[model samples]
Every structure is written in C-alpha cells, then in structure tokens.
Target: MPNAIRRYVRFIDRTNEIVGLIMMYMIFLMIGILLYSSIMKTVAIPPLWTLEMAQFVMVTYYMVGGGWALKNDAHVRMDLIYANWQPRTKALIDTVTVLFLIFYLCLLLYGGFSSTSYALKYGETSYSAWSPYMAPVKIIMCFGIALTLLQAVAQLFKDIAIARGEEIS
Candidate 1:
C-alpha cells in the first residue's frame, strides 16, 4: 500500500477508536438518567424527559461506536465457514464482502444526511411528551454513519493488502 493510504487507514482507525472510547462512557450517563427517573418516580412525579433523553444517549452510543466495532471486529458474523478459512483466504473473502457492506453503508449515510437536513430545515421534533428537537440527534446519526462508511473503506483497503500477501499495519 502507498504511504498515503496507510496514513488514511491509521487516521480513521485512531479517530474512531477515540470517539468510540469516549462514547462508551455514555452507558453510565444512561444509567444515571434511568436511576434518576426511578428515584423520582418513588418520591415525586418523574421527569418526562428522562426516558427520552436516555434513549437519545443510547442511540448516540451504538451509532457513533459502530466504526470502532468494525475496526475491532466486534460486530457479529456467521462464522460457520469463515471461521475455518486461512488468513489470506479470509482476507480475499473480506475484500469482496466488504464491498457489499460499503454499498449498504453508503445508502444509509445518504438517507441519514437527507433526514438530518430535513429535520434541521423544518425544525422537526419528536412526537412525544418531551418533544425534543430532532436535528441534534439526526446530525449525530449522520456523522456516525459517515465515520462507519470511512472505516469500511479503510477495511477494504486493508483487506486488499492482505489478499495480495502484503501486510499493512
């Protein structure tokens, strides 16, 4: 691989790793919100925003962490035959299969950006009691999707190198 491509992969991997690590702490935030809600319910009227806010946090967690999951190979797979493959064989298969993932991610990112733009332009809000503005979460979703897409491309490059019997660190 060229130095530029190697740098690109490293940059994407590092960026996603940092973001994913930071986002991992959000689980604690969600837990705190739920705990507050539960305590409030026992003592007084529970805040209407607690549950919805926690949901938003959860969305941020998974969506933003997606790239890191891919980089770390944390995503689930049907390893029936894949698990038995040799390293180069596995890389060859991944080089082909990752194209499908890239295609799907591209479509998802397109829709995510479109929805985010609509939410921003129309000042959309969730149809709930708390009714929070939707743009922030929508934007986050798009950003996350974009990160995942970039990571997918990086993975494709890495797989190509591996398939060609050229290891890329």
Candidate 2:
C-alpha cells in the first residue's frame, strides 16, 4: 500500500477501535440505566433521555465502525454461495459487491448530509425532558458515513489489485 493510504488506514483502524469500545460501553451503560429505571419507578419516572442518547450512539457507532468491519471481512453475510466460489472468482464477486456498496454509500452520504443540515437548520430535538443538542448527533452520523465511504474506496482499489493478480499491500 502507498504510504498515504497506509497512514489513513491506521487512523481508520484507531477510530474503529475507539468507537467499538464506546459502543460496548454504551451497551453496558444502557443496561445499567434500564435496571436503575426499573428499580426507581416509585422514586421517579426514570428518564427518556437515555433512550434517545442510545439511539444516537448506536447510529454513530455503526457508521463509524462499518469500514473496520469491511476491512476485517467481519460483517454478517449469507456466505454459502461465496464459500463455493473459486478464489479468483471470489475476488471478482467481491469486486462487484464493492461496486454495489460504493453506490449505496453514495446515497447514504447524500441522505445523511441532507438530514444533518435539516436537523441543524430546524434545531431538531429529541422528545425527551433534557433535549440535548441533537444536531451534533446528526452531524456525527454524517461524518461516520463519510468515513465508511472513504474506506470503501480504498477497499475497491485493494480488491481491484487482488483481482489483477497483484497483492493488495
């Protein structure tokens, strides 16, 4: 790999690691929050803020972690057909899949940006008592999508190289 690509991939890898930890933490936090809410029913009505916050974190983490999943080939898939293909044929199929993802991510980026802009312009807020700044969450999602799209382009190149009988790195 070129130095620049390698550098960026390292950065992406770090981002993925940090975000994965954050996601795991969020899951634990949610569980704790739910238990607390259940226990405190008589004390108070708990809070809806946790729900909205969890939703935002989930979206952000998914987008940011998507590229890392692709790099590790860790995404869940129905791999029965893929497992049967020859190596070279698998590379071809993988290339085709990458192309499809590229197109799909384009749509995602566009939609994400539009939604972010709308949320920012309208000062959108979650239907919770503590209506935090939701625009930051919207923008983070868009940023995450952009990160995945960048990695997709890199993966497309890597796949092309592999298909052409060249090592990816």
Candidate 3:
C-alpha cells in the first residue's frame, strides 16, 4: 500500500479507537450516575437529571461505538453463507455491499445534517424536566455517522485491494 493511503487508514483507525475510549468512559459515568441516583432515591431525593443525562450519554455511546464496531468488522452479518464463501468471493461481495452502504450513508448524512441544523436553529431541547439542548447530541451523532462512513470507504479500498491479489498484512 502507498504511504499516504496507509496513513489515512491509520488516522481513521485511531479516530475510532479514541471514540471507543470516550464511549467506554461515558458508559462508566452513566453507571455511576444511575447508582448514585438509586442510592439517593432511598432518601426521597428525586434526581431528574440522572435520567436525562443517562439518556444523552447512552445515545452518544451507541452512536460513537457504532463507528468503532464498523472499524473492527463487528457489525452483524449472515454468517451462514458468508462464512463459507472463498476469500475472493467474500471480498467481491463485501465491495459490492459497501457501494450500497456508501449510498445509504450519504442519505443518512444529509438527513442528519438537516435535522441537526433545525435543532440548532430552533434551540431544540428535550421535553423532559431537565430540558437540555439537543443540538450537542445531534452534532455528536452526525459526527459519528460521518466517521463510520469514512471507515466504510477504507474497508472498500481494502476489499478492492484484496480482490486484486494485493496482500494485506
């Protein structure tokens, strides 16, 4: 592989790694919040922010972790047939599927951007008691989807190279 492409792929990988770490910390924080809230409930102190913040953190976790999962090839697939295919055949199938995925992701990215824009313009906030601004979570979601699309492109390049008899080490 050329140095530039290799570096780009490495950058994507690193981005996913960092995102995954952030997600992990977010999950830990969510757990702590829930535990504290549970303990506080025994004393008749209602922690409304705990539920709202937990929901936000959960959304961020799923969105960011999705990209990391894609980077790791951990997305769901039909293993019954795909596992039996030869490597070249698998590569071809993956390349073709990736093309469709790119199209889908393009649409998703456009829609996400539009929705995020609307949220920012309207100062959208949750309907809960906390009613925090929604723009930040929407922005994070769009960013995660964009990163996942980038990882898909990288995977397409690898699949094409593999189809062309290039050794990937």
Candidate 4:
C-alpha cells in the first residue's frame, strides 16, 4: 500500500479508538444520572431533566462509538457463509459490500447535516418540559456518522489490500 493510504488508515483507526474509549465512559454518566433521578424521586420530586439527559447521553454514547465498533469489527453480521470463506475471498466480498455501507452512511450524514442546520437556524428545541436545544445532539450525530463513513472507507482500502495479498500496517 502507498504511504498516504497507510497513514490515512492509521489516523482514522487511532481517532476512532480514542473517541470510542472516551465515549464508553458515557454509560457511567448515564447510570449516574438515572441513579440521581431515582434517589431524588424518593426524597423529593425528580428533576425534569434527569431522564431526558440520560437519554441524550445514551444517544451520544452509541453514536460516537459506532466508528470504533466498525474498526473493531464488532458490528453484528450474518456470518454463516462468510465465516467459512477463505481470507482473500472474505476480503474481496467485504470490499464490495462496504460500498453499500458507504453509500447508506452518506445519505444518513446528509440528512443529519440538514436537520442540524435547521436546528441551528431556528433554535429548535425538544417538545418536552425541559426543552433542550437539539442542535448539539444533531451535530454530534453528524460527526459520528462522518467518522463511521471514514472508517468504512478505510476498511474498504484494507480489504482491497488484503485481496491483493498485501497487508496494511
């Protein structure tokens, strides 16, 4: 593989690893929020934001961790036939299938950006009582989707290299 492609793959892998590790802690934050809400409900009225805030954190957690999941091959797949394939055959197949994933992610990212833009332009907020601004979450969603898309492309390159009997890093 070329130096630039190797560097690009390494960069995307490293970036996703760091972001996913950091976001993993968000599960604890969500837990703490829910725990606080539970305790408050017993002693007094629960804060209006606790449930929704926890939900938001959960969304962020999964959204941002998606790239790492892809990089690690943690996403579920139908492996009945795939698992039996030879390494080069698997790589060849993956190279073709990842294009579909790339295309779908592109559409999702475009929609996310559009929604985020609308939120920013109109100062959109949730309909709930807390009514938090939606832009922040939308922006995060777009960022995560972009990261996942980059990871998909990186995977495609890696697959190509493998199919050609070369290894990337």
Model 1 Cα lDDT, one tens digit per residue, 119-162: 99999999999999999999999889999999999999999999
Estimate the overall C-alpha local distance difference test score of candidate 2.
0.73
Model 4, residue 80: distance off in Å is 0.6
Please report, in order, the local distance difference test score of every candidate based on alpha carbons. 0.95, 0.73, 0.85, 0.96
Which candidate ranks first by lDDT, i.e. highest? 4
Each candidate's root-mean-square deviation in Å? 0.6, 2.7, 1.6, 0.6
For candidate 2, the per-residue lDDT at 101 reads 91
The residue ranges of model 3 lying beyond 4 angstroms of the native Cα positions read 1-3
Candidate 2 TM-score, C-alpha based:
0.80
Give the better candidate number (2 or 3) by TM-score.
3
TM-score (C-alpha) between model 4 and the true structure = 0.98
lDDT score, candidate 3, position 89: 85
Better of 2 and 4 by lDDT: 4
Clashing pairs in 3: none
Error of 3 at 86 (Å): 1.5
Compared with the true structure, what per-residue lDDT tens digits does model 2 show for residues 50-84? 56666776666576667667767788889888898
